[model samples]
Target: MTTIADRVRELTVAREPFVHATVVRAQEPTSARPGDAAVVLPDGSIEGFVGGVCAESSVRAAALDTLRDGATLLLRVLPDDTATFPDTPGARVVVNPCHSGGAIEIFLRPVLPAPVLGLAGGTPISVAVATLAEFLDFEVAASGDYAGATAVVVAGLGKGEQDAIRAALDAGVGFVALVASRKRGAALLDELALTDAERARVHTPAGLEIGARSPQEIALSIMAEVVRAIRVDGLASSPGPAAARPQQAVDPVCGMTVLVGPETPHARVDGRDHWFCCAGCHASFTAA
Candidate 1:
């Protein structure tokens, strides 16, 4: 059997986002005891067990939510009739219909890889961006590879800046910005044969209008814009269904968001379709 430590090491080295669930409190009739731990992978699979199928479903759901929102969770799973749940701030309560008559408290924490910022040029501004990004808790890459970078910044040093920007855009990096004067930036953009949509993706004169003069100030402005772009990208990428309806369904058992698709387990109840993260959730939903 693989231990939690072994799984943690494996996941850490692989840079996969996961949630660690540990049972800190357990009442009678529960299959799990305090200290039981489990790891929930990105796909809603549990590598360990915190309790029986019912408890596992809830834990899995909470774990996935934590991964998505990058927030730690303290979950309390009780029977459907549980009324006097512990009044605690930030504690999520899950009503378990299939529980044998026990309560389980599981703590879930998300382990996510740091977002990467790729720097294309080794100019003073690039160096400053790297330093400042590090301060902002982003992993900085100076190679301009953009292979796995969430954002790329071309700190122009007069040579190869256009090439770097071209490479970044060609690679479909979600966010790309170039630091240069308006004239130089315009000239370089004219040279590139990018479509209007693609050209619009490039943020020329990268950074906010903070009147930045020095390389350090420019770096700060660029980072601010980068952060804004990241947030905008996130909102645009997952705006749910049209008309603002959520494309993803929240698993009622555990509250994890499940993309509505054939592969996802789902059930139709009360003339409505509900998706679940896993079989365990489906079972719990049916039982309820």
Candidate 2:
């Protein structure tokens, strides 16, 4: 049996984004116990159980929110009629109308993969960049494949610079750079059959203008520029299909908001489809 920890490892290795939700506290009449955990995927599908179906609805919603903002959240799911506990600071509180008179506290943390830097050469500058990028918590892909890389640097000294640059651009990498002299870089860019917009995205004579002479210094300048592109310029990794925002719907039976996905319960009535948080809600709506 694959444990939650094992599933987490698989997701991490696959460079997928997900939310780890652990039940920290549970009130009476709730099915979930303390330490019960679940992995919520980017599509809002849950791998384990955190609580009852109604509580899972709240957890799913909050998990997606945490994934979006990249923040850890303490979620308090309470019954609609219960109000004894005061709101805790920095914790989100959700009252479930369909909850069976119990409460649950779940901790939601988003696990995001580290940024990948695609280095397209084995030159001294490329070696230095790989070392520095690893130190800065970047995953170095030295295979000249930029499929999922957030940044790509061509330091092959004009050997395969054009092909690498074209591949990086086609991969939709946020930062595409080539290490060469200003004159050579401009000439090389002109050689590529790319549109004006695509050509503009490439950074020639890569790295910040820090007067870097040595290979190590040049690597440092390149890393600094990559950091600026990520932090200041907001050029983070290109989001995959799984990172798309989850669609949502409101369950009319319980007035609870639920994520609309393959896992959600659905009903077609009178030529219209209605989504529900759980089968119980779906049954109730269909029966009435």
Positional deviation of residue 163's Cα in model 2 after best superposition, in angstroms: 1.6
Backbone clash numbers for all candidates listed: 0, 0
Which residue runs of candidate 2 sit more than 4 Å off their true CA positions? Answer: 238-247, 261-263
Among all windows of 10 consecutive residues in model 1, the one with the lowest summed lDDT is 235-244
Cα lDDT, model 1, residue 148: 62
Model 1 regions lying over 4 Å from their true place: 157-159, 232-288
For residues 1-288, could you state the per-residue lDDT of candidate 1 as single tens digits?
Answer: 779979988997776778888999988888899999988887677788799766776776677778778889999988877744576799999876656778889999999777788788787888899999999988888775676667788876566887887777766676788888888888888888778977887888899999999999999999999888767556122111222222567777766555554467888999998887678778988997
lDDT of 2: 0.89
**Residues 1-288 of candidate 2: C-alpha lDDT, one tens digit per residue:** 999999999999988889999999888899999999999998788999899889988988999889877899999999988865678887999989889877889999999899999999889999999999999999999786677788999997465788888888888897897999899998988889779888877898899999999999999999999999988887878555655667889999988999888878999898988999888889999999
lDDT against the true structure, each candidate: 0.78, 0.89
